[model samples]
Structure formats: C-alpha cells, structure tokens
Target: MPRLVAKGRSHFPFLALELLTFPPAHRSDFWSPICLQVSAAAFQPAARSSLLEPWCRSSAEPETRGPGPRAMEQQHLASSSALRDTEEPASCSGVKEEVTSCSFNSPLFQQEDKNGITYRIPALLYVPPTHTFLAFAEKRSTSRDVDSLHLVLRRGLRTGHSVQWGPMESVMEATLPGHRSMNPCPVWDQKRGYVYLFFICVQNHVTECHQIVLGRNAARLCLICSQDAGCSWSEVRDLTEEVAGSEMKHWATFAVGPGHGIQLQSGRLIIPAYAYYFSHRLFCFPCKARPHSLMIYSDDFGVTWHHGSPIQNLVTVECQVAEVTRTAGHPVLYCSARTPNRRRAEALSSDCGEYFEAQSLSQQLCEPPHGCQGSVVSFRPLMIPNRSQNVRDKSAPSVQQSPLLDGLLKPEEVAGAPSETWLLYSHPTNKKRRVDLGIYLNQNPLEAACWSHPWILHYGPSGYSDLAAVGDEGLFGCLFECGTNQECEQIVFRLFTDQEILSYVQKD
Candidate 1:
C-alpha cells in the first residue's frame, strides 16, 4: 500500500462555505521541492548584500543606503593591505635559510710571488676561534724582511657577536736569545698553562754540500704565557736546560699527544714527542730513515721527563696522534701522518703510549701533490631505530629464487649494522696547495666496501687552516685566509656547528 499526506493550508470559502486542501506529491517528486527550499535558504544571505538597499527603500522598512564612494575606496584599501601581507618578504617572515650552501670551501690554492720566485703555500691556521696560534716559515729576497719566521694570533666576528684580537706576537725573537734567525713551530698546552714553541737554530752552513745549510745546532722548548689573555706574551722560560743533556741536539718535534696530558687513572702524565731530521739540501728528495717517531712521559707534569721506545713506523714525517675511545673495549691511540708519498698514513698503538704496531693503515685517496697537514676525529655511530615487524622477514634469503634455500625450512636473515668513522684533511692544488677540509666515512679502516666517497666541507676562493673540535660547545672551527694573493693581510677563524654536518648528510 502507498502512503499519502496533506501538505499545504486548508481554506474555506466565505460565502459558499467550500473547503480546499492541497495533497502531497509522489515521494520521488518530494525531494525536488526540498532541494529548491534548501538552495534558496543558503543563498539568502549572499543575495541580501545587493538586494537589501532596494528592498529597504521600496518597502515600509527603515531607509538604508548602498555604499558611497568613500566606503568603496576604504574597502579597496583594505583588500590591498591583505594582499601585501600575503606577499611579505621571506627574510622578514622569520624563516631561517642559508645564505650559501655547498659541500666544499674554496680558493682551492694560492701562491705568492715574493722577490724573484713565486712561493705559494697553503696558509696554516688562519681561522679565528679554532686557530689560537699559528707559526710558519717565510723567506724574503731582500735583507730588510729576510728569511724570517712569523706567528699570527687568530681573530674574527662570531655569528652574533663582535670581538677583536691584536696581531700575533713574535716568539722567535725572545725564545732564541743567542741566535737572531730561527724557524719555529708553536703549539698551545691548555693543561700546562703555557704555549710550547719548538725551533731549530742554524749552527753553521756547509758551503761544500749546500745540503746542510740549515743543520739544527740547538733545539729549545719554551714555556710561554700572556697575562692579557694571550694578547702580549711574557718572556719564555728556558725549559730545554731542565731535561738531561738538554744542551745536546735532540732533533725532535714536540706535540701534545694522546690524553692531552690529563692525569691518568695510573696517576702518570703522558706527553708525546717525535724525532725527525730536516735539511735544506734534502728538501726535494724523500726523508731518510734517520728521523723517527718517539714518545715522552712525565710523572710530575712537565717537571720531569722520560723518553719511551721509538715507534717502529718511521715511514712518515709530521705525524699526529689522537687519543680516542670509540667502542666499549678500551681507549686506543691513533696516529696520522703527512708523509712524502702524497698520501695519509695511519697506525694504532695498543700498548699504553709506550709502543705502537708496525703496520700502517693507508687511505689510498689522492692527496694534493704538495706537503699536507691535518687532523682526524673518531665520532660515535649514530643509530636509527627500526619500527617495522617486516624488517626481519624482508632480510631473509629468497627461498623461491635459490634451489639450495628451497630445501631448507627457514632461510638465514642478515641485518645491516651501522658504524661510522670520519677523516678530515686539507685538500691541496697543483700550483698552490690551499688548505681545504675533506670528510670520509667508513666502517672498517681502508676497506672500500665500508668507505664513502670523500665529501668537501668548506672550500672557496680562500684556504682553510687546521681544524679543532670544541667538544664543550659542539662546534668544529677552522681558520681561513681570504686574500687575492698568497700574502693574506686579513685572516679570520670561522665556526660551523654539528647540525651543519647532519644537514649535509640529509641533502646527500
């Protein structure tokens, strides 16, 4: 049975008394009226803007007027303001962005034309915060400047702050009291509260050989400090005479090696030293076996010293050792070298700072054709959590594809493990080997399967010096020399954060 109902009002005739009523339509037609009613109700407010004034003037409602010229102008002004806000400049909108992003820093190389010949070498330790002190040998044709050694103190602007440091003071003048000319290498010792400067004084020149022109007659280690926060250093005390037979030519390079002279668990002080032979005559050829690497230990800080057995690996000169505890096992001393081969060499020492293994780890990557100097840091592996249950299932061997595996009930599952090792060094060029930073990662030492292609951190039209890790502040700082020519008038130290490295990885 079908159901029907009355819809509209019922009317009665006045005179004849007749009644009229409207009946509902079919259910299919019923929706038509309802849809029309809903659409009209929705559009009433929108239509009222245009129709309201006409309705108000024509009807008994109070008279209302449409917008005047002034109101229309104000409305247009408001619209323009809204559009302007939408198109605001990016810098003013508080969106952080990089000024320039690249993997390498540049000015890849530089050479200075002083006197008759061109002498272009990478400027060492020019950056401000990381480069506390820098020392290098410079030769001039004229006697006025002469063949002199120069040292510079680093200074620059922090990202959000301003600070200035004075020019680097001359240490060779005061330290080499008797000799007027000397070549020096300076290193700062935070633990000993002094800067240790090493230099070789010319004993006498050999006119016959011409090779032994700069034979080291005397080697002196000075303990220097400045009261004005390293601005002006006081006179260096002669610490060389304190060592036994200190007057004799020891022929060594002093470095603050592994442990940074921290009081050990055994209550002993460990300082690392390496012995090497340098000659102006042998400058073009490779180094001989005479120069070797050695370690020195002091029980009462620098007050007393005992020389340890020399490391058997004497293949490289300018060696550097870093104390690191990478895995859970034990802390090991890692050594790196800038050898004559134009490649970096590494070795590990198991014994407690006394002796190291003979075999070396070679990074076969191409180094700049000239002399190189840099450092390495061993960072812990960064682990990412796996949340999928199918990870193990996906790692299983494909039984369907292999006949040998199909016979077995279950296949073996191999999970990829995570491990990271990083190496940083200066990249050199053919004409002038400017200092630049390169990073490489590996799970195993010198193993291609575990290694990554080298990535450049900062290289530009300028060169970077040595890099230092400020663990306390989580910053990797570098000294950079920005000059059109090799002679850099202004040097600055710049700081980059750990987040920058992570961001680089993400982009790659």
Candidate 2:
C-alpha cells in the first residue's frame, strides 16, 4: 500500500511543483518503493534552464576568475579533450577537470510542502547481492533539526550504467510515540541478510543544545532491520540501556552517524557515533562538555550491541568507519570524524571497534569552520594482470577486457602501485562555507599525507553527504544535501567512476 499527501508549495528558488507518482506497490515486487505523495519541484524560468542540465562537467570550461597555476591547469584541462578523456598525460594540478557525472537533477527528497515538510541528513547503503541502493534521509517538518519527524527511503536498482529509482516511502516502523526520529544510518549485513537502519529517537523537540546545557542525555539509540533488502522493516528496538549502559549518565547527549556505518571483515557491525563528555561539574550543575567520536559494534550479527572507547583527548563528532586492509595483510579499522578545528580528525583501531589508537588531525582533509559531516568509504584498488601474466595466459583464450582496465598496469608491473585500502571521502572543498562538494581519494589509508586533492562534485552550496561504493571497485554513489541558494533544499544523488576520481584527484 502507498500513502499520498496533498501537494504543497515550495519556498525560495523553486517555481512549479511536479507531483510525481508511481503505481501502487505490489507484494511480489519487494524492491518497488511505496510511493508517498512526494512532490518534485522544478526551478523557476529565471532561475535555471532545465532541472536536467548538469551543474558541472569535466569537458565543460572551468569557472575561473584570476590567474594562477591552478587556474592555468584548469584552462589546460578545459582546452584539451585528450586530458579530459585521459588519453594524454594530465597535469597533477588539473583537479578541476570534472568527471563525467550523471546528476539525477530530480531530488530524492525535496522540500515538499515547503511550509511544513523538508528533508535533511542523507545516508546511503548499497547491497551488493541485489545491486540495490537504499537512500535514506530525515523527513522533517522543517529544515531545523528539532523538526525531524520521520525517516524516509527510496530504493534504486542498478541497471547497467544508470539507476532506476523507485518512489519514496516513509519508514513508519522506525518511529516511536511522542518522539522524533533523526539521523538515518543504514548498514547492510551480508551474513544474516539484513539491512539495519540506525538512528536516534529524541523525545519531543528537545534540541542537542538543550541536552548539552543541562548535561542530560535525551537521545536514545534505536534501530530497525529489514530482512528483505529494505522492502520491510521490523519494529524499533531501543538499545540505549544495553549499549550505552551507565555511560549515558556520564555525558550530555549522543547521536549515531548521520551517515552510513561499516561492517568489518570479521562480521562485526560498526556504527559511528559521538557523545558530549561531562568532564566535570560545579555546584552540582554540569558545565564542561566535549564531543568525542566512538563506535557501537555487534559481533553476533545484530543480536547484541556494545560501545567502544571514544577517541581520547580529541574533540570529534559525526563520524564514519572504514575497515582498511592490505592484500594478504591484517585489517585496520579507520575512523574519520567532523571536528571544530579547521581540519578533520582520524583514529585507528587494530582490534576492530573495541578501541581506537593513533588519533590525530588530518591536515590534508580540511573542514569548514565549525565542521560538517563527511563520508569515508574504502575499497580495493583496481588491479590488472601483469604483462608477463598476460603473456602466460595468451595460450588459454583471448577475452575482451574492460576499458577501465586498459590503461591500468598490474601491481608488479608498475612502480608505486596503489595501496590495499584506497579510501574515498566526500565533503565541502570550501574552507569557509559548505559549498562545492568535493570527493577526495587516498591510495594509502595509513598515511595521512597520501590524500590527494579533491574532485569537486557539485559547485553550489552543499552540506552533509554520504558515499557508498557501487558496481566495480572504483565506482561510487554520493547522496548529499545541496541547493541553488542554500543547502538542504533538496537531497540529490550522483554516481562517479574510479577513472573520474583518479583523473580529477591531483596529488601534491
């Protein structure tokens, strides 16, 4: 069954409302999204040409102002098709050359009913087995955090190079009476075949500031699982008492990743979270509080949960976890988090999410002012057979190779081959404002210095984002908050290839 709401007006920058609908859901098609009365808006005539026009492209001219090496390289990138197509040697600083991006100009969650309902905080989960992508966001009464009401979802099926997206559906089971559900963090468990959606249920409209000021924990850890690849969900389970234990009393408030979580190689589910530590109290009133990123993990699938130690002596929040491991090497759990500092912070865990070590700030990954939520996803580097190995195999059969593997050399053939754990990060490239959503790559996850310059994804105002590895090793899908005038006006989804990431990412 599908629920439909009346069409509502949109706020600034949008013109006409387009009521998009899908046929009612059939019980047999589990992947079909239960259409809700969701309205997609089109830009005003004076605002832009068409909603389908791409915001940016690699082959398009770079928007330049003044002269500099970076600007010159951008000019070169724009002038040369060989460079744009990666047929010739591209300069290391030609990072502005955009990748061939397919922007679904239509938002998954738009500010439908601008006077009331809005969407924010996007989280993405890709189920490899089904080649399905689940996009989640906080359906709010307004853009404000306290107005968060429901968690909505849309399922996209991978069809060749493009995705066929279903209509939006609200996760009614993820909510509790008198409480608002926020932060939709979804993770897939291949072992038990469950898609766990983790979020915080805050009572009424109590803001995080309210909990921080009074030094009281108002948020509760809750989760709902879908056994049928997000088609249906189980009842909400409150894991606050069992997971946080007495730790909740020692702090103000906490929230799980406003992004996606990770599953370790050993079948452990890691949910990134942060809490305000109640450092000390004076006159029986708590005053000092600091944020630290921590983890909630489950070893026996999603049956039981436990909290791990937070990043010691560092102020970090809104984090994501990635399990990094070299080929035939031990696994290393890496956590990157948002911080108040101008740069993001990193912590490593050798024994899974039980403990974190080597906490430090990533000078290369700059964060805007007070910081913004970013996404980190790790994947194996694209590898090809060595020439000698190819010669050895020539006698067997001649098989067609993918274009992506054409230019790539084998690890044994090339010097400085890509490391085992290559990480893809998404955040705003601007240091002052949340604009110009950029995607960064790190060939060597263990070395903070190994991060390359970002490939700007979206040019205008952008905020919170989530990245999920899709298709091959280098292909990724980004679900983020972006708008023409302000962030969070709508949640957009785009896909990027490894070749695009490598072509646009410049190493210093």
Candidate 3:
C-alpha cells in the first residue's frame, strides 16, 4: 500500500473521501477520535494498479469506428475519430465548514443551474476513447419526480489536475407538443464507437399513477446518438416500435434507468429498465401492480434494440448492469437493482442480458421505506492477481510484476483465473433513511460476504448516484446527490484513486 503517513497526507487530498461519514453523533469518533479511519481498499488502488495491468482500453487514444463525422444541424461535431474536452481542470467551489468540505474536490452538477432549481438523479459516463465523462440529470423545479422537470447535461473535461465541467447543455433540443423527457440512460458501444442516450417521453399531464389507472403505455421510447463522444449528438430518434416492437400494446408504462448502461464484452448493449404489466382492462389508481427489472438490449452495435425478459418472481426497478468477468471461457454479467422489500436485489446472467438466473436480496444494501435508485460499475481488482486475465494495473502502489506474475512463462504452461469478479456499488448506507451516501466494494462480487466496508462518498441527506471507472488510470468518479442538511441540496461529483478508497475500509 502507498503509505500516506501522518505527514504524507499532502499528496492525497481526495480523502474528502474519508470525511464522508454518517451522523457524526452516531460515532464515538465524533467526540474523541484519536485517528481517522480509512478503508484498506482506499490504499489498494496504487498497489492494485501496479499489480494488475488494467485491461480497460480507454486510457489510450480513441480510435474512429465505422462512419466518419455524422453531419447534423446546429451540432458542432468535431472529427468523428478525434477526442475533445476543451477545458482546464479547476478546483471545486469552496465551502467553509468541515461537514460541507467533502464536496470541494469535484462538483460536476450542483443544485444551482442557470435557472435556480434542483438537479437530481445523476447519470455518469466514462468513455475510454475520448476520456470524457458526461454527467446527465433531471433539471427539476422541485424535488418531486413528476414536477416541472427537463433534462440538462454537463461534460467534464479531464485536464490532468482536475475535472473541468463545461457549461450546462440542454438535451431536449426538439420539443414535442405535450411531452416531457425523463430517465436519461446512456450506453456506449465499443464496437460501433457510438453512445446511445435512451430516454422516455411521458405526457406532461400524465404521471405514473395516472398511467396505471388508465392502463395504457403513455411512455414513448426515444434516443439520440453521438459518434464523436458527447461533443455532438444527432437530432433524435423516436424508436417506439423498433425497440419495444409489439410490447408497447402491453398494459402499463415503463421507464429506462435514470443512470448509465453497459455493453457486455460479447457485443450486446444492455440498459436496465422496468415497466408495469397491464392488460386492456385498466388497473385501479393506487396500482397494486409491480414493476419488474428488465433490460433493453442491442445486438448489431445499436443498429437494432430489443427488450429482455424481466427477472422472474422479483419486483425491481432503477438498476444497473456490469460485466463481472469477460475472458475467453467463462463470462458472467451482474445486475443490481432496487427492490420494494426495503433491500437491493441482484441477479446473474450468462447470456448478454437476454435472460437472467434467479434473483436474491442483499442483506448489506438497505433500501429506504420508499425505494431509491443506485449505481454499479465493474473493474479489475486493484490488488490480488486475477489468475485468469494474466494482466494487471501497471501503476498501482509498489508491486514489481516479474515474468512469473504476468503469466509469461514457458510456452505451454497455463495460469489460474479468479473464481469470480469484483464490483463497486454506490448507495445511501443509512438503514432507515436515505442519508450518508457511501460506496461499497466487493472483491469477490458473487459472494455477498466479501463486500468491503463502505467508503463514504458524502454525508447528510443524499440520493441517486452513478459510478464510472476512469479508463485504465486506476481511478473512478462518482456523481451523486448530497447536501449538508438535506438529501439533495446538490448533485456532487468526486474523482477517487484506488489509494484514497482504501481509507474507507469499515472499522471492524
């Protein structure tokens, strides 16, 4: 581990990561803390990077795929094959008090926008090729989900020192006569080198309860694409039939994840979503019908989109999927979703999001009385050598990978692979309320017992979050809702190195 002794703390300032704690009154450290506690995994990043050569290909230059620049009106798209983020890294807006300082490192999207309103349900995306992070959210006038809301986005330019956020941009360039855009879910297809921003449009006057009672699918499936990262985007593609096919006639309405999507290594693009099931007969208002977690997948590099079957016997909503393992022989996909039973639900799929195995609840992930959305991302374990991939992060801590460790031995010899995959989940760690937004890591993702103590992201009232692994640089960024006194006074963004996360190890 890279030792940040009592004095060497200057080199590491991201531990605003450490200051992210639950109700200080609930801890003994609040009164007489002899020393600050940090997660062991926090320090594991440098070591992990040095040991595992991150297989993530984004750290390198982004290559141009299929087509050249897609010409669009009012869209200043750069070269299709080039990367762009024209800004310098700057420090976070200053806050004086200790409790509020945690947000000083990164704050991509805050409550105060051009129009004074709140921004909630953050969705973060890390495109390896362009090395850009697109932070998307619902610009709401009030905290209410159905209130006056529009979609706004900010692009984070990686300028070596810090993330420089561009001016907020409006996503709904085209206006429908009576529709409102909600649920901003994006999926990146490495093969086609495209980013699909999938969302749904519901009539402004029609809410979820209104649709259920009406027993009709008022939600329209729509999408916009960008060939050169997020710099420019196509006008918009309304795919109500192409995506849902005949399923639109079903009963209730559905929504895409308010977070990010995944492209399985097998070349399938999957977006976590849920829809209410109904028939021609309308269900009563306080609808007893449940929303089941499902996937909207694409096969031909997003040329065609299809919805996957929901997890049987489980009711889930607002979830994210990640490829836990993607080497030659054994491949597994992990899905984490919010459940109504006051807990998070998870399922594994061998196929590319078409069908999943059984689902189960996580004892560690506690949902509030009302369910909330959470985010998940997968990456190479910073430490332990995965016997399979035969590669590790090259810049982690102090590990010197000799030929033996890298599996470059005699011609015919084989190496051992990790039995499972590793995952990082972000949610509010508070048991009863949506407070103390923290992140948990599982070195052995398949085994719930292996989840590490949460590395707190922000204290106080916090809601909906999205996690992104920053290419192969042994770093990651979290875009979440946090405030000093309320859950979402602001939507904050913070970038963390593996070393800083180790300090968040639970105090056993």
Candidate 4:
C-alpha cells in the first residue's frame, strides 16, 4: 500500500520528493533533500493523503459494485503529498511538474538537480535482522558507461511502512585510480555477521570490445567486506588469479551480479556471474561469441572462492539465484538469466553452484533485445498450491480472499518448518518494451506452466530490479529502475504483502 507524504518540507530538508509534477520552467523550484534523519511523526497515513492525484486515480480507482481489481486498486491520490528520502534516489535530471506517481512503492534513487549524474545501474541489499536496506548504484556523470562511473551507496531504515534513507556516498572508488569498478553484487553472511560486496575492475579506457578482440580477460575480480552492517568497509581484495586461475585465458570479459547475492542455508556464499567465452580456432586464431552464466562461490562463508562450470548451450547473462526444493526433498540452486533470443534461461545446480543442468527456455518469461537483469528471492513463507486448490481456484470466476493470505500457502505447509518451495521473480513485464514490471511466482520450478504472477508493481517505465524480504514476515521490498517515461530516470522501492499480491480475488 502507498504511504502518505509528510508535511513540513522546510523542517525536514532530507526528503527529496518525486511528487505531482510542476512545469519545466520551475525545475529549480524543486526543493532538494536536507538531512537523513527523520522523526517518526513525519510519516502520514496513505488513506487521507492527496499525494497521487488525476493520473493515479484512473489506474487504482475502485468500483461501487465490488472492492477493486486485484491488479489495480482505486484511490483518490491527492496533490499535497511529499516523498521521504534521505539521499538522491536514482534521480532523473528533469521531470514534468504535471507528472505524479501513485503506487504501493515510491522512488528510492532520484536524480539530483544539483549533481550532473544522468544514468546509473541499481543494486539493493537488505539486512533481515536489522531491517536495514543498502542501495547501491554505479554513479555516472553522463548516460553512457564510460570509464568515469563509480560505486555509490545509500542506506534506508525500515520501521513499519516509513523508510528513512541516508545520503549517498561513494562506497567503492577504484575508478579514481584510473580503472573503473563496475557491477556491485552484495551478499550477507547472516551467521558470520559479515557482508561481501563484489565487483570487477576494468583497465582504464579499455572497453569490453577491446578485451574480446584481443581474446584476453582484462577484468579483475575484486571484493570488499563490511562487518557492522555497512557502517565501515575493508580494503579491496583482488581475487582474479586465485579464483579465475587458467579460466581467465579463455574469458573475454566477466563480472559478478549487478544485483544482490545470496548465502545458502548451508552457509555457502554464491555470487551469480557470467562471462563471454573466447574460442580459439584450429588455425590458432581466437574468436568470441555468446556469454554463459556461472557462479563464483565460497563454501566457507567467503573465506575462499571458486568459479563454477558455466551453464552451456543456452546463451545467458545478468542473472540471479535462489535455493528451492522442487526435486524430491533436496534443495537445488536455481538460476534465471537474461538471453537474446527473447526468453529467460533457467538452470539448477546440485553442487552448490559448481555445475548446472540448464533448463529449457521459459515461454512465460521473455528477454528483451538488450537483455535486462532480474532478481530472485527465496523465503519459507511462500508455498506451492496443492493440486486440488489450483483446480478449484481456476474454475471459480469470483471468490473472496483474505486480506493477509494469498494462494502461496496450503494447510500442510502452513506450520512446522514449511519447506515446499516457491520462487518470486521481478522483471519488465513486456518483451517489446521496458514498461511494466511484474512479479513472477513459480511453485513448480521444474514445470514452466506452473509459473504466474498476480501483482504488477508499476505500470510505467521499469527496467532492472532487485528483491529483498524484510523480516520473518511475508512482506517484501523491491528496489528497481523506473521512471515516468523512461526506465533510467529513477530507481524506486516498493513493499507489499501476500494479501496485496493475491487480493485480485474478490473479498468476502
């Protein structure tokens, strides 16, 4: 559900609102954010707020005959709303004053008018124990990914619905030394109380094309550790020689996730990555082609790392992984990656990401031409529907649903250490355009036909996204690239419940 904007813009200078649009001429009238700290009283309720008006009213309005469609809820969004963020969200440079946003989630990364950054990449990491969110982006001075971009970070405090974010700072600045540090893939070691941030450092002014044509892997795998939940970070550690070993000779280019990484239940730390392979012909000439998704894993909680066998045959890039129990009672590492042929490629690894048996292309999930990165998350709160419930729900045209429960759980899996696996994926909903972002739900990961989603987080320009579960609760928060007319304008965050996702079913 959408939260109401707080009053006192002058008193709370830390908030940079992406509210109802004004006009182009008055772009300077947009008051920038002040401090990161916000009082609890500053938060308002969503019901009586006028933040989202005219535009939001049509999409989320309710009918007199019934409550509302599960996909869209009707609410009279007011114009007098304010967005609360401590730092500059993946902010767009210019926005029309008439533009307004009304959704369950708001922008997390907004462009700063004072700063010259126009485009960047987004990555989100959530600490379940502390309810803290770490937002990472590759900051840039212009739209292109030249050798100038540096890694920047912002932290968010989630206490209930209100999230007070801190100011942005350059977290990793290898670019200052002439090399560019790109692609942030962060993973939390909940048991060890450590977070590992991974990235690749490319030589100064050397493009991926240059590395491919030379048939050499010039990118260096680097990592940094955080102990106090990102309050401080250790020095960068280069692991290219140890982890890549002789494999770098056959690699044109490689990098870890441009998103969040996961620590499996077995205490294994796996960072999703991919690389373009360099093929040497019989005449001793090297050639390059499609990339393959692979895993960089550390079995002893990031003490040491290794490169897993890449998923073959299917060309895949930028992907995410989750542990699921679709095969008998055993847990398998499942990965979903972006492809050029229009469908996302999925694979399962039995050896903790060491090797993968790639599944066929999923017709339900399509990959855009340029390929967009998607996010995957695993939580026990979700359950695959029983055989009978799926049939019954499909037959019924209209049915009332609990405001708190979706078809994610069945009676048998409701109690105990519920293990029936379900995976949630977030990506652009359309194949031809990067407009809508839908959350894909798959109960039977082995069966592509069993995949579906009931929630569309945003109906605007949305590109890449990362998903995180807040606490032990079924609540989820999404950090993604979104804008009014273009995907690169901003990076937004959204939180929703199972009920909100399944409320499409009529309420009793």
Sort all candidates by lDDT, best to worst. 2, 4, 3, 1
TM-score of each: 0.52, 0.73, 0.71, 0.73
Q: For candidate 4, what is the TM-score? A: 0.73
| Local error of candidate 2 at residue 153 (angstroms) | 0.5
**lDDT tens per residue, model 4, 1-508:** 1122433432221122233444567445432221111212232111100111100001111111221343133111211223543343322222211212324555555655323564356778888666678878776564334433678877766666555565566876334365777788899999898978898887765545434333445688999998866767898889999998987767867778879999887888999998877555312223433478899998888889998988887877788999876433457688888775678787777677888854557656786554567898876554344443331124333332211112332323332322356677899887775567788665445332445643577666567788887655667777887655455566766766655554532221
For candidate 1, write residues 308-419 as lDDT tens digits. Answer: 5555654443445545443233455555654434555565555556666543435343433323444444444343223221111233332222221132212231112222
Q: List runs of model 4 lying over 4 Å from the truth.
A: 1-103, 112-116, 173-176, 281-285, 326-328, 382-387, 391-419, 505-508
Candidate 2: global Cα-lDDT? 0.67
User: Count of backbone clashes for each model?
Assistant: 18, 1, 28, 24
Error of 1 at 456 (Å): 3.2
Provide the lowest-lDDT 10-residue window in model 4.
Answer: 53-62
- Model 3 TM-score relative to the real fold: 0.71
Q: Give stretches of model 1 more than 4 Å off.
A: 1-113, 116-146, 155-167, 172-174, 178-218, 226-228, 232-234, 239-273, 277-289, 296-299, 377-424, 427-452, 457-464, 480-492, 505-508
Question: What is the Å distance of residue 449 in model 2 from its true position?
Answer: 1.5
Model 1: lDDT to the true structure: 0.34
- Give the candidate number with the greatest lDDT: 2
- Stretches off by above 4 angstroms in model 3 are 1-105, 112-116, 279-288, 326-329, 385-420, 506-508
Q: Tens-digit lDDT track for model 2 on 143-250?
A: 656667889888776644555566678889999899999888899998999999999998875556545545667788899998887888899999999998988777
Q: Candidates' lDDT values, in order?
A: 0.34, 0.67, 0.61, 0.61
